[model samples]
Target: MHCRPCEPRHPDAQRGVALVVALLVFGLSAALLVAMQSEFTLFYQRGSNLFLAEQGHAYLRGAEELATLALVMDHDADQSREQPRDDLGEFWAQQATPYPLDEGGWLVGSLQDLQGRFNLNLLAATVTGTGEDGTDSARFTPAQAFFIRLLQALPELQLDSREAIALTQAIGDWLDPDTITRPFGAEDDFYSGQSPPYRAANRPMASASELRAVANVTPELYRALAPLVTVWPQTPAPLNIHTAALPLLRSINGDGELVPLSEMEAEALFQRQRSEGGFASLDALLEAPAFADKNMEGVRSLLGESSSWFLLTAEVEVADRNMRLYSVLHRDERTVRAVARASGSL
Candidate 1:
């Protein structure tokens, strides 16, 4: 009495089960492989980016070294002016100096005369006049006057003479210490009237863009003036003569006697000076008929031929990536000091 034959198993069912298990295993392995590959690629990219960034940093350091060496070599080298001559009085006006980076990229470095821009810190010291009533007066200096006129020229800003003057005074007040009243000056009291109730800066601006905080200064005005002003870690003073813009030059010469030049004329003069190899002296500038009777002495006093501080902007490109580095250098006695360094990628 052997056991009866079990029902025959279905061939298709067995094959179907086998197929399902095989598919599940294959799918899991494939998913794992994809995940591993993705992680590996991410790691590789991270390493590559790190390497490029290191190279960029090295290039920037090299620039600093070169600038320092130049400063040391020339006892008479003046960083204040963006002269055509380098430390040894050699010309240095080209961009994109070659470097020894083996990664097949270029380092573009430029030394800008920080003196070209108005020292925001100086605004307080320069605006020194008492009103008829013994209060601080917001009269403009030659440079500030020029800056205001330039603001007026910008079609984007809709300010009139009174508003422009007020804005100028407000900026001065913002940088000054005392809260004493000036026609255009604003203090905590004045700002308290606004919805937000902010206080005046009462110190040098940390950045040129901060001008928007001053009373009567609109974004439009700030944008117009941004190109001409700068805030360094050091005290704000007169602009560098070698780097001063043409508008600044015209303003210095005109000294409230004549109207400021058009943008085109200003740019033309700037190009001419650059082409002719920076103004040898303020006299040469005054010799021009446009500046013949303009105030040359004041201009020279405000813009010196040498600079103690400078701003370096460098761009490094590797493969398809680009990085920009901004550094501030200060020459103290015989040493070159790096005040700050900022980097960005694109």
Candidate 2:
């Protein structure tokens, strides 16, 4: 009754089991190899992106240095002249030709006078001496008045006198330290009810873009005003008449009436400033026929021929990676230096 205890398995059966094991092992190894390759590819891409970003930033820094050098050279050239002023005719004001780098890529940079635009920080400055009713009230500073006029003068904004005043006061509230709101302005009390619930800055704005956070500021309005105003020189910097846009130029006037310069009149002054390398003095500017009857006191104080704050926009492209750098440059009698910088946009 002894069974065939020693019956060996068939060769085909053994081969079939061996083939199944081999297939399983091969499939697992192939899957593992694919995963490893995917991970390696991801890391390689990350490293390549990081390298390109670093390289692009380095080129941007070089471009900033070039801008600084150009500014210094401009200062030197101006020093030799009897009246030193920054104007569009200067070399630094011209659009820079993109510099072809030794490696693939190019660099472009240009300097802009921030003083050519109205300083929004000036809205915070107020005179509290007296009001028409002899009661204590915050009165608009000369600079604020100038800003109102500038807003009204901008035909593209299509803002009326009252709307301009309200916007100006709203900006002032955003900057003033106290929570007391202006008659037409908003404070933390107003902003706290917003969807996200944010408070006012209650200090100088870091960038003109901050206007977007203020009340009643639309994207279209901000876009229109951003180019015509600045937030730097938070301590009431004069507007550089030579580089000021036509809208700002037209906004100059006395306090009695908001009589902005006409387009033809502003264009005349603009052309004259460009051809004459800027007005020799404030008195010379006042001599314009448009200003003959208008009181020039307030506008005169707000206007200047020189600028201390300038913006440098530098763009660099390397390895298909593009970088745009914005630097705030401060120029002194001694040298020019970068005060603040941002990547992508101002």
Candidate 3:
């Protein structure tokens, strides 16, 4: 074929192609290196977090053990006392100061006597009489009356007379197995009408916080009442007059009574009784002058020589992670046992 030989490719063009190929390979290698480094860092961080979390859990368990041991010791010591009473004077009731941990973070825990508050479930203790409907209608007990008085006394609770009565009724209805509701109380029917409908729990409350569900129990009221009332143990715990709120004591004494003690009198009685140790007996409490004519036979039934149940709170923070633990402990002269345990991450 006739021809002319093909011209050689341009030297600059050949060099340009070579340079472009080298740049593409270098770019890919650089991206791959960066991606691998990011993956390695992520894995390292995850491993460190997991290790810290595991360590934090172990520490919380250890904290619970220590608390149980302290309760056992405290119970034995209380038994040695002449009155054998548990009050704010005891070691367990002392304010807990945060203690530093060896590894990192601070461990702070506190023990609260559950019996220091009124038991809401005590409403169920009354033996009912035949009602208008012939059903086993629940009768109002002293505990219910005390709760009503408590709701009425706390202005900070922000409840009107109607709200207080309604909320108290709802609580009683919740604890009573019968569906029959009081004049101011709510039933499953009322709850079902709510937006996010729920049924009334016609049984004993599992916790103190459940009062939030009662009709007309606003957040403010619950906050005020939570510290003064509980639903534990079914039976009423004898409140520590030393640690019990003045309002609770006043409520138990009935504010509308023929001879109601003034706030000053209640406070004065509290100050006098707690000057040394707590009141040794209900007779001693009755002699406080504030409750001179008050009927204490029922009140005495709700008194305690010592507390048997306590709530333990343990808060732990590790590596910016938080863990909270709540344990219910029951202590007797024989042994201390953990009744209920709950844990969660914050």
Candidate 4:
């Protein structure tokens, strides 16, 4: 085919084609740069968070160590004294001042005497004896009686004789390795009928929080009761008369004893104890006018002068990160150790 000489393409059209290609390349490069920037930012934040978490944990562990050392020192000091006892006045029981950290934060810790509270595991103990018919007869032991008295004394709980007895028996049933229910207690048969069925532990409780699962222990009751009881020491120990609250103190007595000290009288006794640097021995406590006429045959065995179990709560703050540690520590004449530990609010 015959064709005319081709005309040169317009410079503007050629320039436009080149410009489009440049623009596409520019857009793609910009998008790629933005994506890379976002990825870098995310990695930076993740690493920063991880570092802070590790630092916070280290500080908490350090706090635990410091608490253990303080307890040991306190034990050494008490050994030198003629009357060794743990009380609110002891060094370990005092509120701790916040310690400054190297990384611009503070650490705080405090110790509470676990023995100051009633040991719930004591109820798990069997108090049965053989009757004339050769059948096992169950009765409230001295410890159980003291628990009943404590429940009655707590005006907030408002548990009367019948209800208190039922609750105590229920707790016992939960702990004992048996399916037989007490006259006023609940067993697997009772629990299996609940909305989400469950059974009795049939063993000692690992934590006081387990009380919530028992019969008649409402949330309100648990809140009021948790502070006054403990499930620790693996083996139960006597309540420290020097450290026990007035309510627990008033609960100490045997059967056929008169009504316990009124609030006013108990307060007087508490004040006297504090002023006299706590009781030197259980006998000294009994000799006080408070027990002149009160029957105390079962009381002596339930009282002690010293404590071995304590709770250490440690808090650490590093920059914007805050953490808390709860540790159950056991102290002895030789050393101190943490038996249980948890992080966050307990």
Give lDDT per model, in order. Answer: 0.66, 0.83, 0.73, 0.81
Candidate 3 residues lying further than 4 Å off, grouped into runs, are 2-11, 125-127, 130-139, 158-163, 234-236, 254-261, 320-322, 344-346
Model 4 lDDT per residue over 218-308, tens place = 8987887888899888688988888887778777764543235667767777786677757767897877776777667776888898899
TM-score of each model, in listed order = 0.72, 0.93, 0.85, 0.88
Model 1: per-residue Cα lDDT over 297-321, one tens digit each: 5445566655667777877777767
What is the per-residue lDDT of model 2 for residues 134-226, given as tens digits with 9 covering 90 to 100? 522226667877877788787777787788888988999999999999879999999999999999999999889899999999898888898
Which candidate number would show the highest TM-score if scored against the true structure? 2
Against the hidden true structure, what lDDT does model 3 obtain?
A: 0.73
Ranking by TM-score: 2, 4, 3, 1
Candidate 4 accuracy as lDDT:
0.81
* lDDT score at residue 183, model 1, on the 0-100 scale: 73
Ranking by lDDT: 2, 4, 3, 1
lDDT of 3 by residue, 275-309 (tens): 85566666777767666665566556666656788
Better of 1 and 4 by lDDT: 4
Model 3 error, position 258 (Å): 11
lDDT of 2: 0.83
Q: Give per-residue lDDT, candidate 4, residue 310.
A: 91
